[model samples]
Target: MSVVLLALSASLLFLPGLVIGLAAGLRGWLLAAGAPVLTYGMTGVLGPLAPALGLRWSPWVLLGGTALFALALAVIRGRLAEPERVWTRSKHLVVAGSVTLAAGVGVGLLFFASKGFSAIPQFWDAIFHGNAVRFIADSGDSAPSGLNVIAQPAAQNYFYPNGYHLLVATVHQFGAGTVVQALNAMNALLIGVFALSMTALLRTLRVRAAIVAVAAVLCCAFTGFPYDLLTWGPLYPYATGVALLPAALALVVRALDAPRPALVAVTALALVGLTAIHPSVSIAAAVFGLGLLAQRWLTARRVPPGELLTLALLAAGALALGIAHVLGTLSAAGGPAYDWAVQRGVPEALGRLVFFTRSFDEPQWWLILPFVIGVLAFRRLLPLLWLLVASLGFGLLSVGAAAYEGPWVALLTAPWWNDEWRLAALYLLAVVPVTALGLVTVLDLVRRPLPRRIGLVAAALSVLLFGYLSNGLYHQRNGNRLAITFGGGPTVTELEQQAMNHLAGLVRPGEIVFNDAQDGSPWMWALTGVRPAFGHALAGTEGDGLGKERPLLRERFHAYDTDPEVRAAAKALGVRFVFIGQGFVTGSQKRAPGLVELDKVRSLRVVYQNPDAKIYQLTEPDGQRPADQPGKTPPGGPVVVSSSPVKPKPTSSTPS
Candidate 1:
């Protein structure tokens, strides 16, 4: 019942995508409907900084901003003439989009078929720990003695952002509890809009172009191609934000085609959304814009101020939101610690940035043939191609290489890289027109009694390339399945699940739990309704390792996990025990030298022990928790507030 209600409510977010799709037929509303979703998704990236902006939970603020945004776009859309969306007869587009969408879903399924989706029940880690964890931190209720953070001893402090959680949370604002359905429904709607946008954008090329691009993007939308699948960690805001990004880009394409204020405004909204969803999104937007502006200046000096201003404003909104979150954490009386994405050591920082390269998945290898053809035959496609170029160049720069920390990919695909893949999604959309342009010309020629050999060769090449990419992914899924036993015996996955379930069984209905698995690895927290020890995406820390170098850094991590100190930190705001998993965490490099050597393992009795994990009841419960532990706050006062506040709704869709 809760899920049903939430799913229904999530429709609020989903409707925009569908409406935007349908509105592709009604040019005036296309941009207006699409803009906010992008803005919302990007904003989702802000982490603990949102509240300072005076905008986080203020629906009216969003409503007003949206209204203003809509008005701005309406004025512009009204003046522009609609494109010729007579719907072209090109079957290429149909096959293309179908293939692409299929590729994405297929890739996802392929992975599932490979590993079987952790039959151990990932539960809400994909969402709750991803997003709600941030809410706890941003709300300044973070403390270590409460949930996952306090329990999981000696590990990396990932504190991954909860993109899935945010997605679900945001949906809950409108929907309530069943956010998963909401997320899927919303993505489906976006796919529809994505299709419509392609059709409209290439009215010159028609339905065929639309179908090809939409299908291709859809295939790549949630999943990567067959050959190269992604390794996921924690919930990524950028990935879920990608769900909103396609339409947002479609709006941008719309803006370029018609140059209406509405489309630009919509584009601006998308820019804002991208900004909010992930640092990569924000950085990509900024870099991509610079590239576009440069191209425009060199070739066409007559760019409009409205277009530029809209982009700037959207960035500002994202910045404001992000900054607001930072300020909140920095100012908290017993504020959270800092985790280092930045460094006192540039070389080390650069080292962390190395992995961002994993994000580089170029458009289909065959994109080259289509691109050349499109460039030669369709002049208008130049602008679209350039946009693709800019997005790619910038996305590469943005995914600029970062090492993976925790379960999430911190490099180019920060947080939720798994579920969303926003950067890749947008880029794919831009490249489709180039592809369509090429195919149309080819088909026109192939129709003639041209050499049968040429057509056969082209067809064979296309199939081989597609199959090459597809087959690899099919097999990759097979590789994800691995079996490990705990304590040389118990199933690692099962034991962890049992430990979590055990913890959950002990909690009262409204209690909260916390864990110290950093932020990204929500496995420990997701299954049991607990707050993560670290803030979202490890935001709000001042130094490396959960930012403990910041004064009393230890205290903040506790709070981020919804320390018992905070009224609503845990399910009952009371964590009865901490389950440290040998399988779940490998410990951090930065820990004190003898940390792991200590009898910490010998000290705690195992509630459940296996070769893989040992669930332990704390030698000391929350009230009697040791202050010396990493997340334990100094003994200035109680570890908890007198009366815990109500836990946030289960249905909420935060970025996770």
Candidate 2:
């Protein structure tokens, strides 16, 4: 039942965009592939605007806004006629086959990787993402401009893209399920969108339908993309943007090919969607668009004036936006710049790229053979060659040459934080299609001399062989990685979750729980109805107002019995309970004395306890006990006996 509701909610991600695309005269594969990109644009625009218009962000508002905008587009275009039949029967089959294969492999891997819909990705960014969804749902504000309110209640404005969160929050608001479930459902939908968008791009490029189908299967085979981002930073918004890039590039191709007003408008809408989701990907798309334009200009005997104008305007807009985004002129917080140290020498980095590996994943040396074959087979194709070169160059620069510290490199790669994983994913976006084409070339050569039925069987066997050689689309390894990340002990265990569930009954409404966020206590708010003082693990120290009351509380809240300052801070913060989990989150284990020794605090009475977790209610600072649970413990005395006793349970599980 939960999965059913989640599926239904996930389908909502397509409606607004589909309506807009249909009204704008998008047909067949274009309509199917373009809807998700338009959906992100609609949500990204409306999320911030809804609050200003004195309206709450909801699915209805999204649909209504899409309707109004789409109607305006229809009126301007002056057409609502019957859709044309642009796709052939083979095209339809290709679409179906591609979507099924991509979704089956992509969503199937994700399902097992997550363990279930309710399990959260135990990574750093996931902490912010999960809490951000709750913040939007609870505060009724989906604007990224004010997202920092999740961590700091008094934050005025902080800029972070919230398209992914808005989409997930919309599903959550629909009563689909928990935030984690909604997130998982949306992730599954994005995987399908990635496949659909890539199909659209390949079709626009006039690739063979067989190659398109092969490309769909290969999309899930690459571990660098949609899967790596899911595990690494769990960079959901960036992944969302990356998923939509192919479709946006497809629109760019269409507009460049014809320069029709409607096509250009749709392409602009796609870019807006990309920028809203993650501006870095929009920059990447711009880079590709520029290459396409350059190739056109360099080859054309006489470029049309209209085409020239269209291309120039696009280039100018992209340049201006890229400059603004990199300069941080678009937001108050400014653009992100990271000084990640070079982890590998140039030789090692280049070697990793040559082997189709990124970060620490196993190398896929087989990809090189197909890529080389495709390049040799289609060496005359300038656009394909350009894309191959440009993507590989960017990959090399991001991974190998990042230590250069040049201004040009910094300006270009700053939007991505100069991260190697992100650039590697972008690199795979171009290489995968070429590799698929190469595979098609190989199958075609083998099929030319054989009987039709035998040829078909041989192709099927070859694909299966490829899958086997690639470790079953790399699912086992990626799934194991995800399982370890999601499993208990690294972050929160079943015992800890149960204890939090039990505290849901004890923690009253309008009360804040002081939590050792390092111990995964920040998830208390996400798992239970009770609010935590810190919404994320780093909320206590990372935000503004360091060396203030919040940081003091974070470090010395357990000394409330002996420290008047701690007591005052806790009282002012309205911290009624303290939640302690088993240990710190993975890769973030540090002994926080104030949070660890809560049992010694006389003012804290253990209200709920489990082997791996405990919840304590703050007693009055004075000697008097609360009327509900009368205890005879004086202030600054030894710990008061609790009604619930803690018990020891043996366990061998270790944090990953």
Local distance difference test, per candidate?
Answer: 0.39, 0.71
Candidate with best TM-score: 2
Per-residue lDDT of candidate 2, residues 1-656 (tens digit): 45775576657778888887877777777788888888887776677678878887777878788888788767756543234335678767866787778777776767776766667666666777888887777767866765665565655545667777887877888786887777776786666788888888877776667777877777776767777787777788898888888888877777676565555565666676787788778778878777766776777766668787887766555444233232332664352356556667777777777676664456775677887887777752345655676687678666644445567766667767767777888888777878887888898888777899999898888878887887786777656655555655556667777777776776666877877667777777767757777776662335562226667887788778889899888878777778887756655467566786777777877766766777787876553455543554432234333344444422322222
TM-score of each candidate structure, all chains considered together: 0.57, 0.88
- How many clashes does each candidate structure show, in the order listed? 139, 0
Could you give candidate 1's per-residue lDDT for residues 354-467 as a string of tens digits? 222123333233445554776577564555545667646433322332222333333334322322223334545455555556655665555445567787676546545644
Which residue pairs overlap in candidate 2's backbone?
Answer: none
Residue-level error in angstroms, candidate 2, position 281: 1.7
Worst 10 residues of 2 by lDDT: 647-656
Q: Model 2: how far is 404 from its true place, Å?
A: 6.4
The TM-score, computed over Cα atoms with residue i paired to residue i, of candidate 2 is 0.88
lDDT of 2 at 48: 69
